[model samples]
Target chain A: MPDPILAARELTKSYGRGPDRFDALKGVSLDIQHGESVAIVGKSGSGKSTLMHLLALLDTPGTGTITVDGTEARSLSGRKLNGLRNEMFGFVFQQFFLNPAASVLENVVLPLKIAGVGARERRRRGMEVLEQLQLADKARNKASNLSGGQKQRVVIARALVNKPQVLFADEPTGNLDTATGRIVEDILFDLNQNHGITLIVVTHDHDLAERFQRRLYIRDGLLITTDEEHAA
Target chain B: MKPLEILKTAIANSFRSKLRTTLTVLAIFVGAFTLTITNGLGTGISNYIDSQLAAVGPGNAFTVTKTDASGGAASGPKKYDPSIKRVAAGGRPGSSQLALAQSDLDKIGAIPGITGVAPVIRISPDYIQWSGHDKYQLSVSALAGAQPQLASGTNLDDSSTQTQLLLPVGYIAPLGFADNNQAIGQDVTIGITDATGSMRTVAARVAGVEQDSLLSSSGIAVNKALSTALSQAQATGAPSTAVSAWTDATASFAPSSSAQVSDMKSKLSAAGYTAQTLDDRIGTVKTVINGIIGVLDAFAVIALLAAGFGIVNTLLMSVQERTREIGLMKAMGMGSGSVFALFSTEAAFIGLLGSVIGSAAAIGLGTAVSGALARGPLSDLAGLHILAFAPGPVSAVVLLVMVIAFIAGTLPAWRAARQNPIDSLRYE
Candidate 1:
């Protein structure tokens, strides 16, 4: 097995200060290796969201350190953090944040454009990703005109266009119906199995968490390894 | 992103918001166009005056006697006070003469670097006649011809020797002359009343028929010949002093250079001589036109200010609407500087369009208005008016407007750039 791609040591996150302080993550530690698909399952307000945010570097930990692919994520700032975030991870949120004014293709190519990729190369790469997601036909349509499944597909295409190492999905199927959720699930598994990408998913669904190779359940800001529970 | 690619993105985005872009562009257009047209008119008017001065000749200067039009003695040691208004009781008020005298001319010629002088003279009861026509009943003028200073023809070699006659232009001889040039060197008889109130016929040969005169053609040519005839006739008998009264003298001169011209003017003015130069006339015209243009530029500035406010509002609203977009961009690895550059570049595109429209509109309006004015009251100043639409100045003004527009867009663009990406992305 390869070394851990992401590691957290006694991670903690708090909102506000003093009497109003709310501890979202309480001294939690975790490890995930390369090519691994890990699902963090928890009820709402159980610190799973805070742990995922820290893992993605979307929010800094209040205590302890996170090293992503060898570099310490906690100490990074400004351009270094931005570069690491852009190059290392592809993020999919429960709510697809697509620019409604842009066409599906434009929305997909946006990250590459911000990364200052050349136009021909960016378009070529963006089209390849869209085609892979079976969204080539809707490329020219405005995002506002796309359906829920198609908009999610375009958002996935956008996230994957830069070919990041890890796909961090926060409730990827939370907003979709059962049938559409199954399709998204199949696509996420296919991306992991075929491309050998590390997948870290944060979801509240009990049945969905059981399918992953590894499951860490967070309750009241404390994480319990499902394998450790089985061993006990 | 490369600036060019970013510019393309900005332009496309701006194009997407058509109404907002159009309104902002319109504001800029109105501002820039107003400035161009008003400035054009001012420039055209001043140009017209300069052209007139040029036609009047740069070297030549004017000198007038200290007298009113009615032959009354003019106020001595008085300058032309622009603040004071002259009012006539009833009839046309006798205006102070702006012309200088022959003595002033001689004095001006005596100044260092002084050249030649031609005295400009206008006679009263201006009329003259030949033998078949009656005397003094017809008011004609005889222009006093100074020696060696022919307006067009051969210069006088000896003003005292030659009784050679010179004809006034368009002088139709009494019915017996065959051809137009027939009276060029032929003898023509003139009738003049003597001091004793008796009419006499005097015969002289028309030496040369002048094609142009400082006075009316009905008057006899007062060449050295005619002057000799009148002087001799006066000695022979009490001939018409009334005919001599019809004559007045004027001198025209050419200075060596422009400095000599200024010196001559100052010297003439200092000596209680009311004189005017071609340059001074042009300066007066420029001053008047500049005032008009200044008012127009002021109005343009007001319009530009209003447009600037419009730009600020639009950009601010854009910032609000694009909060998530800005965040997404920032998270995608665009630097803070890129964010600033993108917004400012978008505003610059709007400004560029506005400048193009303004410049084109200004040229169009200038062409149309100048064409109309040419057929209207400004016809007299048309030559100078046409020269006023100088392309260099207009182009510069258009560029200036574009720059001002970019400056106006700066603040909103800066505000858009400074937005915290985390909060912005969290924005609904």
Candidate 2:
């Protein structure tokens, strides 16, 4: 297969220092290929979320390196790193992170606005994403007025507005009911399968992990095993 | 983000906490309002004084007096010298000064820049009577090239061979004239006691009616012809030498630049004469007025700075309240610089709103107050507006408040910009 879209080697991260320090990731290593749907499964404090954060370039690993598209992450400047994240990656969080005071359209167009897109183009692209999420009719409604599933859909539309190469969903459906969570999950998988976007979902749910094409189970800051490794 | 987008966002965010922002703005408003009004007051009075000075027509002339030969005036009284005659100083009552003789006038006229030198001819008329009316006590003096503000008719005809005088407005009703218009062109009899103690009367025609001014009030302005006529009549049987001595002289120069005028004045000083321009005569009044206005302005600025503290408090609270929002924006790839710009721009917008409103209100109220005063208590002082607003000063006040607000916002904006995204997002 082609080189992995995101590669990590012996990555380690810790919290605090000295006696109080706790290792969040202990020499964890992984690779995520383009157009692949992968699940990082672990209970709370198992370092699954920490590993995802490192892969997304939201935080730096204490040791080792991450390479994105054949370029070392540490080699890039702060401005270039932020630009890469803005132009190449998207994120959906469990809490939704929607600005409740803003309209659904405004929340979706935030990244485009930050990218300095013109008002007309921002509105146009924002509406297109909302339409894809089946939220076009609620574009002008305040985000606070939306139901939990609809709010998650708006967050997914915002994540998709930049047309990023990688979509990272950290417990994206954790706050939704089972039926709503299944719908949000299906939408994320659809983006990965049909749109060819790389997907990395961080979750502790065993049933949710079973649906991904690949699953890496982590425990005590170390990856216990991967299904692909077991198959090999 | 683009500057326009940042500014729009800042403006929208500033209104997020309406009551808090409004109270801060109101504090700023009080400062800007007071500043604008005090500034207008200073401008109005200065403008009126300038116009009045123009009316006085002394731009090209100044007064010259003889200083002690020792350079400075003596701090203590000295024994009187017999050779130097003393006379009452014109304009300043009760002060007798050593007289300037005809020889002094010739010397002053010889100065390179000096165009003319004439002693301030003092005439003490006993009374004035017009058309069989009862005689009224009179204070008459030479016009001395002054162009008094005319209420009716024209100025005294300086070149007219016939004696002419401008009747003060207060003298009109007492002289039995129906009004200022009726007094013009009418002849008046001025009676004076000569050196022999004999009373003699001379007739002079009223050329115009003079407005009562802060300066030069209560005196009849007489042209050169009338002045010479009255002097000759009063000096009858006195020594020609005694008549030629004067307390002070009005000297004229080539109306050049101030630098050149000062040079000419220094040359006079070298020759033992002290020269004072019209501005010099009124400088004290201007200084006192400006000093008072400066104190008032300081109070206004103090109020503005206090309001600046209110801006700090308002913005600090906003930064604290929006901690999560700030983290979210930073996580969305916004730079620290953009965050700082957002907060500071909001502060500047608040200042802009308050200053614009305050200055506009000041202009409205000041205009009305000036009008009322002009028609009421200050009716006698024509062409004087107590408050005047100039575009430049008004704009400066607005800019000043905006800068103050921007400065006040810096600390809070810096704190917001330096917030760590992970920690802020984790904040409950």
Candidate 3:
């Protein structure tokens, strides 16, 4: 009944130009409601990754419309856009891009710090988030010294530090071992279950895709199938 | 992020690559050190000259004498002469080489605002000796007429001692006379030529030594010889030169007051006798010495300026090494302005540190260098001894050098701050 938390319509993304124009996302349309658990699954060169980037608002769509929590994504600029990114979406990447030299806590609190949150509130929130992830023991350790699963958890903590409405995970466990990868997935699902947070995941594993209540299968920048297909 | 936070980040990042940061800091240190020391020396030398000049009074005083503008001896005053022509030192024609008689001193001393005057009579080939053992020919530089008596340890009253006594202060020390302050009150002799071409020697006691001292090493042995001959001459009370007769007609009139003295000098000058003022002679000596010091200071500053390039190199390297860190900050939503401020503050810190180091080094070096220079050329000649850590000039120059270094750091900081975040994040 209510509007979806994230919506992408006729989204398209291309790299380079002319003969080299390679479309990463082509006319892909999807929507996920508040507190929804959705997954996009596809093989290599699929538009699933590009679709995730657009959904997270990390990269602008070349041609399409995206709305997150009722705000049109194309309209914001400068501080307004940066604030939107901070307040509306949290991201976990394949590489686990944590600032290596910073402590686990500092890494977790970086988003809030960038948003100019007061120091006491940032530390309190950071500690709470790290505790939730069972990373309180390692909060003082440098991110570089953490295990892969722990590092991914810290990145997740960073993403969720601001308590955003949408969590976008682009192959969050891609770089970890099978055991570490499973632990990261369990933590991701735990965050969804405990916090009732919306989760939009892009992954190649069919098992990961089947775990989501909704699924979109993309191939070669085109949407091949979805649980709910458009009328047209 | 707050400025402090950004600076903390920058410093931490710099420290990560300790060798790079140290090399950068060292470059700035050397640059700032050169700047401070050179400018300090320059300013110190200039101030020293100024103080020394002030001690003698205004340095603009000059004597007008009958001489052609070309410096040839003018037989008499002629038309179209520049009223304020300068009197060259020594025996140049239009120069003040022509002697000032007692009457000239009186007249000049009488001028209303005219501070003081001294009769400078030149006599030569007078033999001087110390206690009869050492002997040498001496130039009777001048019989300088007294002004308001200074607070001197030497007694100026005893006319019977030697009315024609030399002013011990004027003895030019030829370098390297650092020690021995007890040369005053010793016995010496002087021989002058009389009107009949007969030489007579007179014995006299050293009335007083000057606070201003000189040490000419080459002339020290000569001075010893002169002291002995002078002692014998003073003991005999005989004249040393053949043409020792007093020259001025008004030399007989002893002026009752300083005003009376000035009145006498003007009247004599109007009658074709050239005159010299006390200020005129002191100004001439002070000017020559200060000019030399000024030149030296200018050269030092130039050397420091050349060293400024080192600072630029260091800061540039700092920017290069911090590219990724800078990109990281930018990605955290810090605007270009905040980025610029962070770099600028870092530069200011480095500059301030370098300035402190440079100034300390300069003060130490200045002391040793100035001492060496003084000991070599001026110690015996003028008895001037300078200390290394002269506060006024050194402090001012330290501050100035810091500011310059701070300014110099800005360019590199700006370049670093302006780097594109996306591209910089990719930097190795």
Q: Which candidate tops DockQ?
A: 2
| TM-score, model 3 to reference | 0.62
- Sort by lDDT, best first: 2, 1, 3
Q: Tens digit of lDDT per residue, candidate 1, span A1-232?
A: 5558999999988889999999988898889999889999887988887788789877678999998877788667777887877787888878788888888998998878877789899889989999999999988898999878888888788889999889988899898888888898889888988998889999988677777888888877888755343345
Q: What local lDDT does model 2 show for residue B3?
A: 90
**Relative to the true interface, what fraction of contacts does candidate 3 keep?**
0.18
TM-score for candidate 1: 0.66
lDDT winner: 2
Docking class of 3: incorrect
Candidate 2 stretches greater than 4 Å from native:
A1-5, A17-20, A60-64, A70-78, A227-232, B44-61, B66-68, B71-137, B140-167, B181-211, B221-273, B366-388
| CA lDDT of each prediction against the hidden true structure | 0.69, 0.88, 0.62
| Model 1 chain B poorest ten-residue lDDT run | B242-251
Candidate 1 residue runs with Cα over 4 Å from true position: A1-3, A10-12, A16-21, A59-64, A74-77, A219-232, B56-288, B384-390
Candidate with better TM-score, 1 vs 2: 2
lDDT of 2 by residue, B211-242 (tens): 87776658788888999999999999998878
Where does model 2 sit among the CAPRI classes? acceptable
